[model samples]
Target: MDIDAWWGIIGQARAAVGDRADDRDSPDDPLPGALVDVLAVLEPADIIDFYVKHIEVTDAAERYPLMWASFLIEGSVSGDGFMDFRDGLALLGRETFSRAVADPDSLADLPVVVRMSRDEGGWIGFEALSLPITDAYRRVRGETDTLRAAVEAAIDGMTRPERPGGGTWDPEDDDAMRLHLPRLAALFLD
Candidate 1:
């Protein structure tokens, strides 16, 4: 992955989101609006390619604990739910979000993301976020199995009991997810 290129895209998206000159009425939710604006200017496919390449190059498992944590905190506080938050990240386009993941510390100034570092649920949120990515990665790679079935298979094979309740994080779960991310990257990215 071209790290510099990824940073450039992120810088552009942030600037666009922050721009006050565009007289357009800002949505009550700025993040989503910013994301839509960014998407309008960039190719989604290229962003996804950058994301897949990022996962391939970065030791995501070891590197992203904080990013996932922040997502959890942001989700809980915003009441956006993890899935919706992930979708928003998707809308921001992969490159932007990938930069967030690679350098979560940069997000610490954001009130919602700051809570993630302090809250217990951050890790859990991180784990929850991984599931859909894994499924999408598998599908993007043309895996014939259903996403549910694949998720079930992965969960079933786990040595520890699943994290109780819907939105909790488990270290073992994170480990399992880390192992799969590269495969996920390999599937759709050339």
Candidate 2:
């Protein structure tokens, strides 16, 4: 699906959930429920397209600089940690996602980041954002993975790198981290 079409789904979910979309404190995520409600009305083809588009949109945010951003925020990038970080970024909505993808360092100035820095207990990974498609499929088709599996098999056919590559500085180098991510350094490192 096209980027606009994909974002349309996310927009609807965000709108439907209202404040729940950003409620990290809540143990229950109403976003996926809201997203499923939005998805249940769409044609079946569009649902498959939505899954592919979701992956593409999240992958597009997997830049090397953003990994360092993840490290700064989360203390380290564990297996699939960066993946989950990108999920959170996508959930932040189109403007924030676009800004962050274009300028990874700009994230330090965001209100959400500011809150995270202040609340050391806070983290920015929304793994649940990945749930709605499968949930919606099951909700619509009823207790069957066959359709979802076929769609995912087609998506998985195309290949990409395991992890994003290319960075001139090491995460261990405080000076370079500060120099490259000055604002984030002030927020998380300093």
Q: Each candidate: what lDDT?
A: 0.38, 0.76
**Per-residue accuracy of model 2 over 1-190 as CA lDDT, tens digit each:** 7899788888888998886675444577777688888887886667877877777788777678888888887778865888888887887789878988877788886666787888744456777455778778777778547656766786778565677755647877888889888899889878
Task: Please name the candidate that would achieve the greatest lDDT relative to the true structure.
Answer: 2
Clashes of each: 2, 0
Give TM per candidate: 0.33, 0.89
Superpose all Cα atoms of candidate 1 onto the true structure and report the RMSD in Å to 1 decimal.
Answer: 13.9
lDDT of 1 at 76: 32
For candidate 2, which ten residues in a row score worst on lDDT?
120-129
- To one decimal, what is the Cα RMSD in angstroms of model 2 from the true structure? 2.0
Clashing pairs in 2: none
The CA lDDT at 73 in model 1 is 40
Give stretches of model 2 more than 4 Å off. 23-25, 166-168
